[model samples]
Target: MDVKEGDVLNYDIVVVGGGPAGSTAARFAAKEGADVLVLEKRQEIGSPVRCAEGVSLSWLEELEIDNIDSSTSRTMKGAILYSPAGNKLKITERLAGDEVGVVLERDRFDKDMARLAVKEGADFMVKTSAVGLIKEDGVVKGVEARYLGKKFEVRADLVIGADGFESQVGRWAGIYDSLKPKDIMTCFQYRLTGVNMDPDFTHFYMGSSAPGGYVWAFPKDENTANVGLGLQFSRLKGEKTPKDYLDEFIENHDDYKDGEAVDMVAGAVAVTHPPEKAIAPGIILVGDASRVVDSMTGGGIVNSLKQGKIAGEFAAEAVREGKFDEEFLQKYEKRWRDELENKLWRNYMAKETAMQLDDITFDKIIDALSNIELETVTIGAILEGVKKKYPELVEEFQNMI
Candidate 1:
């Protein structure tokens, strides 16, 4: 429906933001016969691309995304990790963590996700922004939204906040806190053409070159790749930015120095552990709004899709049971946490521990791992290998083991 000024709309569930999380929530909820609506602030479902477009394929079957291959740009076999001192460690795609496996054409991927929701009977309005929450005696009841230049109200039995990192929907409901500097990664990226590199493996460079974060090159094609880096907010100096570091790295690399940048993107990612609470009466926060991005890799696609499915199904159940209270919503909270909390917490701690390592220690750790033939790659297994070669280096990571 076209929303005009003074329009008052209603739905069983309203999802704010139309990225993977919001779309997934809408798709699942509408599939269950809920009257669902999604409002995206941007003029299109996905534009002004802000991601490196890397994702792990292992979760696709679980997410039930049937046409993922149409949006995939390249398939990665594994990833090569380079330490500051030039030590290299290669890990297979299955063990390379969540960010490696396939590179996506994110704009197309996001649109495809939203299309799935619409196909399931979810109504979506692009250029619609949720400006505030509507509350009834301290419980969220709906949202005050602006569509194009017209303002309106959308009342719903439940509201899902799937807004991105700087989400305001969760804050308006008083369930989200601002991220600390140490927990934020300011990022920048470029799609470069004519890059000479292996297309089969994703590349990562660690150390002082990208303090507290790392540099990545995810191939989009045989000659094009997304070259990017994230700089930990706390480690950033007044003048040097993520772009500066990225530019230096590219200039120093023989393969990338001659490449031409055809596209550029900049954004911030929350690298904190998931929030203690993401639920309030009639409202649930998912994706970056709830800080569910992996603290170690700054990846959120898989986690967002998982949380969205959980929230959508629960929202549908809430409408059927006539239960929109906080107590009723606790089930959604518990299920998502049970599915993701342990790994998120572990990754958060690992990121914290990694930030303390110097170049020498990083090299020692990577070099040690490179020398071993591990049948399985895991935190405990990697630590065990490092412990055999350099016992002192594994001390700090003992807790993670």
Candidate 2:
């Protein structure tokens, strides 16, 4: 929808992005009969995608989002983790953690999600960006946005920030802090065709190849994959970019050395724990704006979806009760925390521990896991297995156990 210049719009809730989180929030809120609007800065809903485009099927079922077959690129059976020395530990879908179930065509997936929101009566405007917050007496009232070179105001009882890593909405509302260099991961990816790899499994490579992060190959089909790597900003040396590291990795691997990149994407992702506060008066922050990415794996889709659903439900409640104060909005914060905070905190700590390991230790850990036939795969389970075979290797992770 297009708004005229100098237009002043009003809604029960205004969402500051049209990605998965924002769209999901808008859909659920609109489903509950609240007036909602989503403003997307991009001309297209999911053009120039920045995500790794992987999600766990389990969570999709939890959210009851079943109409995704057309958006799915590949259904994965598991993931294979490779140590620096090339030692491999393969985990099946049931135990492969959050990112291995399906590879999505993100552009399509995002559009489909927005379609769901539209179907539920949420209005959306592409090329519209939230440039600032509309605040009254120190409380956020809505957003100051720009669409096709025209500035406008959107007044709402509630505002949700689902803007990605470089989110300004959260900062505009004073609910976010600047991410430290160590807590940011610079990432690069290529949609490569003619790559030779297992189509059923997502593959990961660990150690200096990625430097404090890891490299991944999420297969989109039998002969194509999205190959990418992330580097912890603090670990970067002079003049070496994420693209440089990824190119080096691809050149060194036979499976990808001869492949052609049909598309490329570059971006940065927050690798920090959730913020101490994600809500201010009449405002709530979701997804990357709230730093909810999994520090261990750099995954956010599931967590973002989870948070969006909770935010939407609470926003609807706020609309019904006609209350949008910070205290009233704290219910959203409490519920998301109860459902996701503990796991996020644990993953952050695990990431810290993993970053401290040398290549030899990584090889040892992977070897231990390979030797054990675990009934389930989890950080604690992996740690326990390592403790039995290589006690000293898991010493730093004792607290997590």
Give per-residue CA lDDT, model 2, range 139-256, as digits (tens).
7788999998999999997999999888888887778668888889999999999999898998999998999899999999999999999989999887889999999999999999
Residue 4, model 1, lDDT = 80
Candidate 1 regions with alpha-carbon error over 4 angstroms? 93-100
Question: Candidate 1's residue-wise lDDT over 1-401, tens digit each?
Answer: 68789899989899999999999999999998999999999998879788998888768778887648888999898988898878999888666555357999999999999989999999999999999898888877889999879999999979899998888888877886778899899999999999998888889899888899999999999999999999799999878988999999999988799999999999999999789799988889988888899988888998999989988888899989989998989999999999999999999999999877888988998999999886667778989999999999888889888
Task: List lDDT for all candidates, in order.
Answer: 0.89, 0.89
What is the clash count of model 1?
0
User: What pairs collide in candidate 1?
Assistant: none
C-alpha lDDT of candidate 2 relative to the true structure? 0.89
RMSD of 1: 1.5
Clashing pairs in 2: none
